[model samples]
Target: MKINPAHLGFDIDGVVADTGGAFIRIACEEYGISSLTLEDITSFDVVDCLDMDQGIIEAIFGRLLDDPLDAGLQPMQDAVSVLHSLAAKAPLTFVTARPHEEPIARWLEHFLQPDTFKSIRLIAMGVHDRKTSYIKNLGLKYFVDDRLQTCRKLAEAGITPLVYNQPWNKNGHDLPTVNNWQDIQALCAE
Candidate 1:
């Protein structure tokens, strides 16, 4: 089924940004903690899946959330180009679970062209479970997220949630899913 750009919204972390890749990269580079792969992140809560210390897990995530630019967080492959294409049809909207908005906003600004970034509607709600209400408030009929639990909640709330494929969310749910930005672009027909 095709979805209009105006009716679609996205999650920032695993969906748009390669948060897991950055986490693994940081674990390998900064902390000298090699051996972690994207596939090793079997759970959304990294602490639950990896054998790493809780403190180190929290520290890595803290740096990512607090300063993604400094952490060198990169966008998912083709996300920028696909989003630019979608934005040309309608304003792009994003709702994230990050607490502070400024850091991510800066990150978006850094990647997106000024006019494209200016036209975006980004909401950093800081909580995972509450996106349904905010997404509804934004008049979004569909949202793409990588959290199975969040996608389930969105489904329960009557909004279609396209589960963004990820190692953490793999095989976790039966909802509709998009594996990459190209798949997402296909959903936005005309």
Candidate 2:
């Protein structure tokens, strides 16, 4: 099969939505972590800074997955707009480590135009490194994600990885990183 060179991919949580702030808010309001902030989430794992129990974090993650498109989790408006524009020209796919597709599909549907995407791809990857295989199989020409590890893997596999800037991935500026959807729009326009 021939891969569509125009096919673009995105990551949920950080890149497409403000998962960091939403996560910290959930942790504080629901899990009783009163003093958490975005700065605390300097790493991919919240437990590293919040010092919260793994189970609690897991429960929160489950909640995020439970109603993945919860309105409280603010969608990145610029990204969605850019997505629609790109979708007008070519297919756009959202590839995520989220275990289920329905919630995200529903969530994305709420924000995007009718034809804004070709698919919402989900992977049962409990780790970042596992996404490389899915990207390869999908034959995505370009992939955007906030995790540096995933970006590295995509680059190693010869797929152009656009590193979405986030607090956790700020240090890895060496990667082909983008500051916002505007940067993505620019890249896709090229």
In angstroms, the error of model 1 at 140 is 0.4
Q: List candidate 1 segments past 4 Å from native.
A: none
Alpha-carbon deviation at 67 in model 1, angstroms: 0.9
Candidate 1: deviation at residue 38, Å?
0.5
Q: Could you give candidate 2's per-residue lDDT for residues 82-155 as a string of tens digits?
A: 87777766666667887777777777778877655434444445556778888788777778898887888888
The candidate maximizing lDDT is 1
**Candidate 2 ranges with C-alpha deviation above 4 Å:** 1-5, 117-127
Ten-residue segment with the worst summed lDDT in candidate 1?
165-174
8 Cα displacement, candidate 2 (Å): 2.3
Model 2 accuracy (lDDT, Cα): 0.75
